[model samples]
Target: MTAAVAVIGTGTAAGWGRHRLGRLVAEQTPERAWFHVHPPHHDLWGAREPVVCDAQLLDCFAAGLRAELPVVVSAAPPKPDGPTQRSYAGLAALSRPSGRILVGVHPADAARVPFAAAGCGLLSRAVPGLPTGAREVHGEVAVEALPGWMVGTDASGEPVTVNLPPGATVLVCGAGAAEVVSTVAVTGRTVGSVAGADVA
Candidate 1:
């Protein structure tokens, strides 16, 4: 298990978003008000590994894990399909580990996954009154010292204030060829961000 988080992305318009790209493009509309969550700073001394997962696997993931660890799930928008929106509640439930945090990504995902779920504490983010369910932690605050499990995302530039350290291993999921190089440049890690299209 690598130290990583799911970082799921969804949008009404297809071209505006993708799980592979770290940027979320929302045109000038109410949807633009959605929130995005960034990855937690690397905690070298900590013993927990943050594993990224598909939103489909959230419920079953907690079965064999440490109960005391935290899970920081991203609150991105849900797919416009009815079935996709309905199934999101389970994923939202998984985000509520003992210690949790919310980073803005999408309004639909954020609405379904609130901080008041099963085992969540008071939620917080960078904006005031933005993330309705969680408490607001204004400004650029660091969560590196937190000792527990965490799952989250790097939706775009709005929430990601910290970049990954050097020598980190990343599995890129989609791209033709050039995208792989760009992800490596931004992340500064030797292991590249796997292109979404390349995943077979």
Candidate 2:
């Protein structure tokens, strides 16, 4: 069985948070692979060349899941159109039975979250604020009142907060968020366990 598969997206084209979360999941897994579907023109940090396919990106993603390896698919924001919507629907069907997850990073692709959540076995969201490079905090982001154990820091530099209910996880990355400096500190703390459980 595939350990885990995640489709990550962000509202903006920059994709910093989306990439960060994907990288985090990849780092935590034992033998992980990266795939970029509909990749941007600029080079991605750890992803390989684009996996183009006639099915509007579903083939490559399906291949990854079938490999039974921990994989992350970096995709464009989901659209409501026929082809795009069907592709996401296909993603959900492939992921759910295998017990994987889909992530919507901060400033998530609002259009994609619902489809992603429906298709995957589990759904996680990095909420509150988009990861920023500013040295000092510009403003406060409102953390959602989710129900589970929350990981990651708030804008005030607090250690942890409570949100994201069971069978789900939430990672908070506010403006001026640490650039995921340590996998142990960020992903390893939360996502590592999530992936590890599924793999076992």
Please give the CA lDDT of all the candidate structures: 0.29, 0.29
Question: Model 2, 1-200: lDDT tens per residue?
Answer: 23332232324434776566645644543332221112111221222222222232333334333322122332322222454334333433321121112222222233343333323322334322222221111122111111112244468964343322333333437763333212222221234344322100
Highest TM-score against the true fold, candidate: 1
Looking at model 2, how many pairs of residues clash?
A: 5
TM-score of 2: 0.18
lDDT accuracy of residue 71 in candidate 1: 34
For model 2, the local distance difference test gives 0.29
Clash number for each model: 27, 5
Worst 10 residues of 1 by lDDT: 116-125
Model 2, C-alpha of 179: deviation from truth (Å): 21
